[model samples]
Target chain A: MQPPVLELVDLKKNIKNKEIIRGINLTLGPAEILGFLGPNGAGKTTTIRMIVGLIRPTAGSVKICGYSIADDFIRAMSNVGCIIESPEMYKFLSGMENLRQLSNMDKRITRQRVDEVVELVGLQKRIEDKVSTYSLGMRQRLGIAQALLCRPKLLILDEPVNGLDPAGITEFRNLIRRLAHEEEMAIFVSSHLLSEAQLMCDQVAIIRQGSIVKTATVKDILNTETVEWRLDNPVKAARLLKEKWGIEALRENGNTITAAVGENRLELINQVFVNEGIELRYSIPRQNTLEDMFLDLTEGDEIA
Target chain B: MLRLIENEVFKIIFKKRLLIVFGILLVLITAFAYGQDNSLNRTKARLAGRIGITASTDWKKLCEQQIIDLKNRLESPYGHEEDKPATRVRIEQLQYYLENNINPLDSSAAKFTTQFMEQSIFLFLPLLIIILAGDIVSGEAANGTIKLILTRNIPRWKVLLSKLAALLMLEIIVLLMAAVISAAVSGVFFGYGGWTAPVATGFRVIGDRLETLGVVNVPQWQYALMVYGLAYFVSIVVGTVSFMISVLVKSTSASIGVMMSALIGGNFLSHFMSDWKITRYLFMVNLRLTDYLAGSFQPVAGINMAFSVTVLSVWAVAALAISFVYFMRQDILV
Candidate 1:
């Protein structure tokens, strides 16, 4: 099997000896989107910076498409396209001029490529206007347009949708998904908006206090051990499950009882509820969202 | 590397203040030329008034009459020994003009060009440089756009080099604009041609007396070029220091403010503390490189062309090196 598009091994950072990022390891393959979740000052931006070569890592290395960032910075960065934080632009320049300036950094970005990106990001109408006249959402589109011009194989976006409206976010999300699948590019996105990440990403890596606490597929995070049960007379249902199966009830809402489900617990719970003559409305596995899972994992810490 | 510099150029011209600055500069040059033209006309009328008293058209007799007028002025208390050599040189020049049947009071554009170069070295160009170069590095940092560029595959030193190249290009353009406007406006007010007219330079002031023993005469056009040559050198030296300061600071406004303060403060201190030996080493003192060309008095004696060039070069090189080193090592926080 080929190496993943991006691989981090024991990535660590220490600023003033305080350990900003501590031992981060991750792998992202082509055509995949990994959501990076962390609280405020949890070192998401620091890790992104280290990956893009903005700040040197104190220890360990990042490999992009088999090129080591520390040893072959240019080659590694060449395959990567990133937007860290809100997309700030050269406000004095026209949108077209700004794109042209970025295009000059590489020779392969032809005029046709520039037009293709402008079309991709839907900025053709106001491309000639100075960026000072642009709304924050327009700048975001322009930033993404520039990132795509070089046909990068890995994309990193840090809070890329902060200033975007709902419609713009939807469009941006669709565009990112298309880029990942069509171009076979890996994407690493760090966002505080868990709902957006849930809808957009394939996997999520939850970070706490600079250490990654969990890295799981979105399906796995959404379908963890927690299971919800809907029952008539849920107080009686919870007592019957505790007494009959020696299982503890985790949470009880008005019409529902949720708990840490054991292996094959669905059928067992239904059989126990039926045998005890406790009225049960329905028993279905709850589809958890990324927000619920993230809150559960991060414990409601501040998100920077 | 060249493309990076092209990107930098795009950024600078995109700034709206560029055209505004050039406009003010041209208007000021025109106004200054108009004023100088009026003053020259007044001087010519006064000289003609003195000449009208003479009955003969004989050149030697007219020269003698002008010499007598200068002598009367020198006899007054306002004229000190310090003015003697320049006055004597002027009298000799008039004698030579009379003998050659030349118009001594022609008021050519060459004189205005020289004056413009001399004033611009101390004032106009440095201010323009401070406003433009001041924003080159720090503006990006403050705007957080620096993260985009630094994350590119290029080395940090090359990025600094691109900015430095853009700055140097802007400095050259400023110098060229100074030369162009001064010549064009003054040429409109006064007659256009003075290329071959003699300009006497290399007079030294020795012990309260102006010495002219080694005076050399060059054509006015050559003299204008020499003046701008020295002014251009000072512009580079001053502009580079401003670029380095821009790298050190994080905001465009603060960078421009800091550099402007140093320029204004340096000039202010040079005026008040010129007698101090340490004052001679200040970059502001060395900004007056054209003063050496005119053989003017040194604020601190023994400061000369070679010394000023060496000091300014050292400062410029040091500032440039520091800018590269700091930018290369700096962590992009934004």
Candidate 2:
């Protein structure tokens, strides 16, 4: 069997006696897009750095294409391409020249491959101009071009769409999806934008305070059902539901209550509310999104 | 490794750093050549006034007259005892020139090239090398490009080794540029006609007395080669040291500043503390390796070619070892 394209087992990092990345375990396979979501200072970048061999992990292993990063860094990194923080190229040289410089470092990368990646990233128009003159989106595209030059099986991008415009973000999302689905490349992207992750990744890992609090398939996260009620006495309804049906509902407002229950229980909830002398104005079944799960799992920490 | 080095060299050239070094050399060499021409004319006029002869008189007569003046000074009671050995060496050098029919005072392109290197080897040439090598690694960190390169599949040691190789290659180029510019610029003024002239070398100092036991005469071009060879060696040492600073420091300006201060401060320390026994062990004091070949008076006694070269080699090796070990294990947090 083909090994996973990227794997992190029991990963941990301590910076100056402070545990930064606490015991992260992750696996990504070909044709998979995993979104590494975390708040600021939540060790998202640190974990990516370890995977790419920029920072050594305290006591864990990062295996890329079945090769251990510590024991076989060259072979491990050869199968991986990454943009750790920002896609910084040599601004003094033209984009084409920058690509050429990177391509020169690896013998497997060819001139034709460089041109193909440039075209793939839609950077052919400004590739001949100095990067100092290129816009942020153009540089991001160029960074992607550089990452794709080696035909890597594992691609890691950190905040890939941070400086991109809405249109550029959509285009980047489409490109990433295509790369994952069409080329069967395993992409591990980190971002603080929950909506972006919701729209992009197949699997989402939400990290908080150096640990992975939740990891789930996007389909499973979105499939989670919650029921909302508009009633006269939300506090009474919340208490009564906990007392009777043993369902914990959040008092969203004076007239609203929401609980993590499916649509099948909505009628029963309304019937009980009506029977218990509580007026039920309306009720609706709500679909939980990745954002709701992320907020709930992270407990409303600062995302950025 | 070769591809990595090619990439480094490509970046250096495109950055126009070599051009800057070349420009500085051009401006300084031209000024020095012009100043040297004026100083030579003034010396000829002074000689004409002293001997009651025209400046165009035969060079052999000038040598004889200079020898007589030196001999009289040696006989005079007012002469300092410490100055006698240097004066004696000068008198013997003029005598040798006179016997061999070589005009020691004649200015030429080859002589000017050798002289420029002799004067620059201690300080000026090292400064140029620092400017070239000081930012090779730190500049990448400052610009955020270090992450790009270090994340590649190649090992960090290979990357650093390639950078060092490219820097050494450029150091040699800087020396060549210095020699070529000095020769070409001075040739316009000095007529470029001393390549075959005999130059006296290998004089030594043995206990406050001039020692000429190893003295030999070689053509001017050969002497220039030896002088430049020493200059190249000094340049490599300085380059390696600055390369270490580049790896240790994360900012280009800071790296350059630290090395510049160390170099200038070393000069000051050497001048003020030459009497201290341990000062002879400092690499800065030994930078004047060419002076030993010229048989010049030692600022700090008991140092020779082998001693200085050994000190410099040790410094280069230590700096390289520190650079590699630190860089290999550095976290590269930037």
Candidate 3:
């Protein structure tokens, strides 16, 4: 219903005669969390960098909040807050002072906004401490606090959870959800953790070798399609389901069979298997996970 | 722009190394004042002992007392004509020597004394400039902060402009401190009242027409102003050159090292190039613009202060232009 907050129109980037990104197009709508998934050197950082105006794309344009990054950089960048790679910080300054310095980049940022973001990132207690003394998680929190300083309408983070521990990652996930839900901000984050992306993102865009392989809603990608089943013997189960229910299924492994079966047909397969005296180890229709979808889509090494 | 400039200035003042440099200047100025005072006292004592009188706080009073002593002995009721000639001759000889041979106790020597008291330009001011100018952009690049600052949506030129402006401000601040320190220290020993005293360094450089360049007469304060202007110009030239190197090298040590070598090498080259007409055009040759004050080396047989200023000016502008263009286009990948 609303126009996309961020758009990449056939973006192509070439450096020293080597193409990095090839005709990549993407759009991030308002209040949506789009996970940019890619392996190392897969152009995730490169694409995010172009969106933040860090590097000029060899071809095409990136628009932030309807303003082109090249045509109107000030206006476009004024509303976009980003953390590319590891957040660069002045280590000698206090965490709060780092936020204060970044806050000065935009006139709209106020003292109250700084305080709010510091607390939002759960760093209020340690905000007065020098950045050099901070843990990796605290530093990332401080970086995010700075990014949120100007109350940017769109937030772009590259590997925001890379160095965070479990607790820090959970807090970061909650904070990002709050920003998108309560503040109505569009957040585009790049991460190699597909499970984390599945748990946190509303939508996910899979990138392989600098190109987007797929983009879909988390519900559609994980919950609504392609049921997988685990049985005592996948080959025997596949044969039994094919003969009795007239349903075709593929053997995934020694004991796992995946089938595109309707909801009603799931009961029929289980009943036939039970009558044949086949002991069921795990026979429920398996919901597809982000990791499974990722492996299914990408051809090369799956994990980044 | 003003706020940006203010922020830049704040960054400079907060740097601990720069603060220490200023502190060192203050200590040196204090030590110099003490040494000059001790030397003045010792000279007064030595001269008073030769005249067979104790050194007094007031030297003119001592001379007047000597004249009255001679007059009293001449007008005494027990005095003989024989005693009169000897006393009169003694008084006349002393008066002639005092008037002709000895320097009048005046503020005229303040300029020469102050210069001798303080470390010359070759040592002090250039080192001060190096403390700040050496790290202008290279420090940021070396620390990996350039990428952060540049990515903040501000134009690259604005960042460079802020840095250049900040360094210039720091230069002005340091020069001003030096001026105040020099004045205060020079004031203590010289007893502070001959701002208009003529200061002539006894050195001379013979140019075309055997033109003696050193004896140009100017008021002490005016002479100080000339020195300030010359040093100020040199600082600008150094700042611009160091800034260009800062942009090119991307390491603080390299930028400072290259500029220092250039600075030292420039002085060395000028020594041999006093007769080289083409060497007069070298940027470093004009570095000692104030040397023309002390009747030191002139770049060419006929070159003047205006010619030196022109050479330094051209070099500074060219360096800044290169810095401005290259920094805006740098990859900033770090």
Top candidate (DockQ) = 2
lDDT of 3 by residue, A1-304 (tens): 5557999999988878888888799988778999999777778887887887777888999988888988888888877887877877777778887776666655788889899988888887898988889888888887788788878889998889977999889888998998999989999999988889998899999888778988999988765445566667677777877786677887776777778665556676777777887777766666678888787777575433
Tens digits of lDDT, candidate 2, A159-250: 99988899999999999999999999999999988889999999999889999999999988887798888988888999988998888988
- Candidate ranking under DockQ, highest first, comes to 2, 1, 3
Candidate lDDT scores, in order, read: 0.82, 0.89, 0.74
Cα displacement (angstroms), candidate 3, residue A291, comes to 2.6
The clash tally of candidate 3 reads 0
**lDDT (Cα, 0-100) at A201 in candidate 2:** 96
Docking class of 2: high
What candidate 3 gets wrong by more than 4 Å, as runs, is A1-3, A224-284, A295-304, B27-124, B185-194, B200-216, B272-282, B299-304
Cα-based TM-score, every candidate: 0.87, 0.95, 0.78
Taking the tens digit of each residue's C-alpha lDDT, what string does model 1 give over B1-334? Answer: 9999999987888785567668877998998999888876665556657776422244455556777787677677788765665565455556555655555555677778888878778767788878778989999999988988887777778889999998888777877777787878899998778878887667565533445667677888898889988877888888899999999999999999998888888888777776678877778777887876666565555666788899999999999999988997777786
DockQ of each: 0.64, 0.83, 0.28
Superposed on all Cα atoms, the candidates' RMSDs to the truth, in angstroms, are: 4.4, 2.4, 10.6
